[model samples]
Target: MNQFTHINASGEANMVDVSAKAETVREARAEAFVHMAAETLELIVSGQHHKGDVFATARIAGIQAAKKTWDLIPLCHPCYFEVEVQLEAIPAENKVRIESCCKLAGKTGVEMEALTAASVAALTIYDMCKAVQKDMVISQVRLLEKTGGKSGHFKVEA
Candidate 1:
C-alpha cells in the first residue's frame, strides 16, 4: 500500500500538500448498493416512488455531492470535476446499484468525490423509499478504480 498521505509522521491527521504535484487528468469510479423489499424495487422501476422520480433525483444529488465533497470531508482539496452518476434498479431483486464516475485535471485525484457521490446516491434511494420499507439499507460504497496520478492507476482488488 502507498504511504498514508493524509496522516502525519506523528500519526496525526493532516492534509497532503499538492502544490508541487503535477496536474493530470485523474478519474475514479465508485459504487454503492441498496437492498429493499421486492415490492419497493418494482415501484422504483415502475416510476411510482412518490418522491417523483427516485433515480433521476438521486443522480442529480450524486453529482452535486461530488462537486461539494471537499466541504464534507476535511483534508480533501476542493475540486472542479466532471461527474456522472447512474442509479439502476435490479429486476427480480430488491436492489439498486449506484455508480459514479468523476474526472478532474488537478494535482489531486477525485477518488473521494466519486465515492461520496455513490454513497449519497444510495442514501437518497433509501430516503425516498423509507416511508414504505423502513428496512431499506444502503451499503458497499467503494472506489472501484482510479487512474492518472504519480502513484499510478489502481483497480481495487476486485
Candidate 2:
C-alpha cells in the first residue's frame, strides 16, 4: 500500500520535510467557476454593477491569495513565487471562469497556491455580486496542471 507523505508510521499527522529536496523550478495552474444568474452576469459585463470592475477585483484577490497560501493552509511551505490570475465573465454560460498560475524555484510544489488563488477569486466574484444574486454557486476549483518536483508533470484531462 502507498504510504501517505503527511502521515508517520505511527499514524500521526506531520508536515513533510523537504529540506533535502533540491530546489527546482516549479509551476502550477488552477481553475475555478462561479455560476450565477444571467441578470447578474449582465450587470457585471455591462459595467452597470456598483462594485466597479468585477474581473479586475477578482484578479487582484487571486494574486494576493496565492502569495498568502502558506498562511491560509497549514503544513504548506512558504516560497517566493510569481502568480497570474485571469477572470472571464461568460454571459451566455452565466458563469465567471478563473484561471490562476503560480511559479517558483522551490523544493515544494505551488499547486496549493494556484488552487487557493482560483478559489479565492471565485469567492471574490460571489462576494461582489451577492447583492444582485444570492444564489451564486462556486464550483470546479481544481489544479489544471503542474510541472517540476520529483513527481514530474501533471495535466488534467478535459
Candidate 3:
C-alpha cells in the first residue's frame, strides 16, 4: 500500500517535508461550474444585476483564494504563485463556467491552489446571484491537469 505523505509513522497527521525535493516550475489547472436559471444568467450577461459585475468579483475572489490556499487548507504548503481565473457565461446552457490556472516554481505542487481558486470563484458567483436565484448549484469542481513534481504530469481524459 502507498504511504500517506501527510501522515507520520505513528499515524499522526503532519505536514510533508519537502526540504530535499527539487524546486521546479509546477502548474495546475482546475474548473468549476455554476448552474442557474436562464433569467439569472441573463441578468448577469446584460449587466442588469444590481449586485454589479459578477465576473470581475468572482475573478478577484479566485485569485485571492489561490494565494491563501495554504491558510485555508490544512497541510498545504505556503508558496508564492501566480493564478489566472476566467469566468464564462453560457446563456444557452444557463450556467457559468470557472477555470483557474496556478503556476509556481516550488518543491510542492499547486493543485490545491488551482482547485481552491475554482471552487471559491464558483461560490462567489452563487453569492452574488442568490438574490435573484436561490436554486443555483455549484458543481464539477475538479483538477483538469497538473505538471511537475515526482509524480509527473497528469491530465484528465476528455
Query: In lDDT terms, how accurate is model 1?
Result: 0.91
Please report how far candidate 2 places residue 67 from its true position, in Å.
Answer: 1.0
Model 2 clash pairs? none
Query: What are the lDDT scores of the predictions, listed in order?
Result: 0.91, 0.93, 0.95
Model 2 worst lDDT run, 10 consecutive residues: 1-10
The alpha-carbon RMSD values of the candidates against the true structure, listed in the order shown, are: 1.2, 1.0, 0.8
Q: Residue-wise lDDT of candidate 1 within 1-158, one digit each (tens)? A: 67888999999999999999999999999999999999999888898777789999899899999999999999999979899998888876679999999998999999999999999898888888888899988888888999999978999895
Candidate 3: Cα lDDT at 35: 98
Instruction: Tell me the TM-score of each prediction against the true structure.
Output: 0.95, 0.96, 0.97
Highest TM-score model number: 3
Ten-residue stretch with the least lDDT total in model 1: 86-95
Q: What ordering of candidates by lDDT runs from best to worst?
A: 3, 2, 1
Per-structure clash totals for the candidates: 0, 0, 0
Report the candidate with higher TM-score, 1 versus 3.
3
Task: TM-score for candidate 3, please give it.
Answer: 0.97
Between candidates 1 and 3, which one is better according to lDDT?
Answer: 3
